[model samples]
Target: MSLRARAATTLVLVAAVLGLGLAIAVHHDPAAGADNATLRWFLDHRTPWATHLATALSTVFAPMWVAIAAVVVSVGLIRRDQILDRGMRVLGTVAIAGALAEVFKLAINRLRPPTIDQIGSPEAAASFPSGHVTGTAALLLAAALTVTASRAARTTAITTASLLSAAVAVSRLYLGAHWLTDVVASIAVAVAAVIAAPVVVDAVLAALRPHLPLRLRSMVDVGGRTSVEAAR
Candidate 1:
């Protein structure tokens, strides 16, 4: 199957898993018990250094930092390669993933764990989907997808991004700010966003082709051909 098809299949499977988990969490409250247990375990094992490190990692996904990162990375990519379309695709993935996470948050409206139950200050927002994980996953996945580098470099980038995303997700759980399923669902959403980004970018470029100036149109045509070739 094609790459996009694989991605779509992965997304469907992850969504199903998340859906089943959410159903259990909502209807039976098993997830809450599990979440509590996990938090207890973390608390039992916690040290000052570990807590500090996790908190630091978690900050990378804060909304302000994420926005700044998106701008910096997108602009850097465009400046380095002059691939405006590709840069936009990266930015679009971050935006779409973040928006989708928020929509899910509002829809689920699951409350965060109580402050007395957690190591850190209480979070007041819905916690079914961890925004930290979602944002970090989206940013990392976008970076991995859009990076133009050697095969080894690309592999390394993807691996590092995945690791970093997982670390951030774990940090949320460690802090008791989110349930396990919250991070899981956010990951599913991030994967879907990353997979759909290029397809969406291509469609947008196609629609704009007719309106682009002749010089710019030719450049796009060449870039499109090169992208297709690279995929092979």
Candidate 2:
């Protein structure tokens, strides 16, 4: 494997292991002392105005909304550039990350912080890997990779995504929607997804291209040219 592929694979494996270990740990004892302490600290420091701000931020990053925004943005960008491949990779990263987060939440079935401590309406979904943080991190990072080509631009994009994700993580914690470990695991998963998304999507499209009908195959651009162009 190339160095890029190796790094992505290593990060993904590390994330998976971290997620699984946290899941098992939380399953045995959902209320880990450190998590409780962090939640309580946020709760203790929250003000009415700050609570409202955090609620709005957290709501914006809610998994469902994030998915909707991703679709809209991807579609818009693809239409503007006529680059189906790039857009798909960007959208796929966010979608896959969000789906995995939901699956983990269901399987882990970890509870959110105590309802009484929450600043807004309680979330009905389980909260092991935070849906908000995962969605926000994935979308921002994926979009960064899609929109920028230079190494410097990529670095800036990653930094911006990380900062925005940190904001989302704080929002989730401030609202008492998730534990500390939940947000941490989500960041790891999002990073892994961002790193692997392009490679995975490219591989899938390449493998499936030969089997697709000519008209359909024309929709895919390989190496900066459409299949139809290559044939011509």
Candidate 3:
């Protein structure tokens, strides 16, 4: 099968799994574990650890990563290097996916676990999807696409990004700030961003590449010599 077909299949599988999980959660008593012994034990013994971990994940999911991406693109533009600028095209997909995430969050409005012991509860939001996870997924996807040079590198970046994103979501649960569903929602947001960005970026860059200056036109042959013409 073609690469596109394979990717589509994978996405379908993921959606199916997510759907099954949601069905089960919806049918079950998600809130029955408020007084679970394991959670209480952790709250009693590892409060500090949970707090620290959550805080750290929060930082990773901050807007700072987006700002950094803009900077990277800008720098690439200034240098007349086209690669980074090309990645900007993908950023739009990220934005749309993020917006979708918020919409879903609002619609689901699932409550956070009461006994999770976090800073705030999702009073009117779905706990199944996580906004932080979404943001992290978006940022990581954009970054990974921007630097897609190797299979190992892409795998590593995705892995790292996933771990960090998951950590943030887990932290929310550990801190009692959110439920597992909330974290999952956030991850859905992020995953959608990544999944959509590449296709969008490809179309955009293809349309724009023709307008780039000669100096940065060749990413594959970036080292090709070019003579600058003197200003008239």
Candidate 4:
């Protein structure tokens, strides 16, 4: 599929999942039984080692770690040249995806699983969409798309990143922090963001190119040299 078509499909799937989840939440339906059962299974399977591993995954994808990663990636991009091109695309995807997840959380306003049923302390925020999963998926998928690396290396990076992101999503469920649908929808949002990032970045650069300083324009003109182009 075309990039735009893929992104649109992902977004439509996200909307469908979100709508179903919302309807279930609103009606207090028995469909939640599956969610509860899944949560219970995770809770029942919790071992110290598993808990430690999940905790580590959660910590690595925490807001603080994400910010640190952004700064590090930003600096690396600056050193490589084309911050407005590559850096902005990566950072913008993460920021926009995160904001979208937060907006959905607020809009859905679904309560998280009870603390008594959870492995850790209860989260205070609404939890229809998982922020951790959303951010991790966006960051990893963006990196997979934007990193300047060998094909084999890039494939390895994406594979590892995807597995890690999935692990983090499972961690959220294991911790009883979010429902299955929440994580699934967040993954869709991330995929959509990754697919759209280059398109958005290219459009923005095209619009700004004419007005930018000659030196800046020249640097950003290389923006077309992206993995998205390579795919074609």
Candidate 5:
């Protein structure tokens, strides 16, 4: 692998190790007093307008909605940039991150915060990782990675993504839907997915090229070349 790919692999491995440790820690102490304390603090400190904003952010940034937005964004990238690989990276990152959050939720099966309003919150049953934040983070990170045209644009994109992700994560806590640990774990997992997306999506496209229709094979061929370059 190239130095960039190797660096990304190292980061992914590190995230996996830390995530495993967190899962073990959370399993032993689901309440995670400090985490719950932070969640409660956010709830306690919220103003009416702040609460409304938090609720809106949490609802709007739900995993399903974010996934839908990702699809739209990916289509736009493909159509405008004429780069299938870039679009696939964006979609794949969000999908992979969302899947990781779900798997962790199932494996941990950790209960949501006691103060959480079960009604209208579909993912309130299990909450070791915040699915909304995971999807949001992945979508924004993928955008930052693939959509920028210059160094200044890249910086702006990264800044916007970081701020939006932080807001979404805090919204989950403020709404009493998740503990601090849940959002933190979701961000970590999302980071791993974003870092891996370029290589992973390209590799998958390359593998699928032969199976695609003749007209579509050429589109997949572009991604295959990217896969080879990424692996160099």
Candidate 6:
């Protein structure tokens, strides 16, 4: 994609992300149900085992100070497999972007639902955007990018990613850790990040392309999967 095209794509995505972020923030009605019955199904299976797993997976929303380790570990592992390069890009963007969502939350200092009223108050702290949703979204995107081992694998990847991300969002509400807006914003942030990553990666990859040996550059290019997407 041309630089102008890339810039336009990024602008569109950033605008959408920021727009969705604002929408979720302003629409923070405590009484309203943003709950999706589908996602709450996971909580039904919420055994101690599930909670343990959920707790661990949920840390993608960890404070920036703590997520560094996971990011490092994740990148290190993915780097060995050249095919996994996309995953590293996805996770790295997710880590940085997810942290930003948290920072927004902390700055907004939005109150959790329960504190405002039994039904909850729109009493927001800086919590307009949710980090959990953001992190989960990034992770979901990474899975979508990587887990195409087969038709089954692809199906599993999309379903699991959606469920996990949605479930995590729901958990935040159930735990009263965040307002509904926080969860919604997190999704918006994640989608924004997803839309942002490819365009940036393509540019960086293209620039680094010439310096790398021809053999390596060919491998790096990944057969033009992103060229079309980036242009759009």
The CA lDDT of each predicted structure is: 0.76, 0.76, 0.56, 0.76, 0.76, 0.57
Put the candidates in TM-score order, highest first.
4, 1, 2, 5, 3, 6
Q: Estimate the overall C-alpha local distance difference test score of candidate 6.
A: 0.57
TM-score of each: 0.85, 0.81, 0.65, 0.85, 0.81, 0.62
Candidates 3 and 6, the one with greater TM-score: 3
Steric clashes per prediction: 0, 0, 22, 0, 0, 10
RMSD per prediction, one decimal? 3.4, 4.2, 6.0, 3.6, 4.9, 7.1
Tens digits of lDDT, candidate 1, 1-232: 4777956775785576457556755776556677677778887888899999988987767767987898899888756554456667788888878887887787678878777767767798888688888888998889887655578888899999999999999999888888887887888888888877767766787788788754333242445655323332
Q: What residue runs in model 6 are displaced by over 4 Å at the alpha carbon?
A: 1-17, 20-78, 99-109, 114-125, 210-232
- Cα deviation of 82, candidate 5, in Å: 2.8
Off by over 4 Å in 2: 1-31, 210-232
Please, what's the RMSD in Å of model 4? 3.6
Residue runs of model 1 more than 4 Å from their true location after superposition? 1-7, 10-14, 21-25, 29-33, 213-232
Question: Candidate 4: lDDT of 99?
Answer: 77
**TM-score: model 5 vs. ground truth:** 0.81
Per-residue alpha-carbon lDDT of model 6 for 51-92, expressed as tens digits? Answer: 555555455455462356447645654544433345446666
Q: Of 2 and 6, which scores higher on TM-score? A: 2
User: Which pairs clash in model 1?
Assistant: none
* Candidate 3 deviant stretches above 4 angstroms: 1-3, 6-45, 63-80, 83-86, 120-126, 148-152, 207-232
- Tens digit per residue, CA lDDT, model 3, 56-155: 7666555457546645654553354434344464456457556766566555455655633655433434555655566666666556555445799888
- Residue 75 Cα positional deviation in candidate 6, in Å, after optimal superposition: 3.1
lDDT of 4: 0.76
Q: Give the clashing residue pairs of candidate 2, or none.
A: none
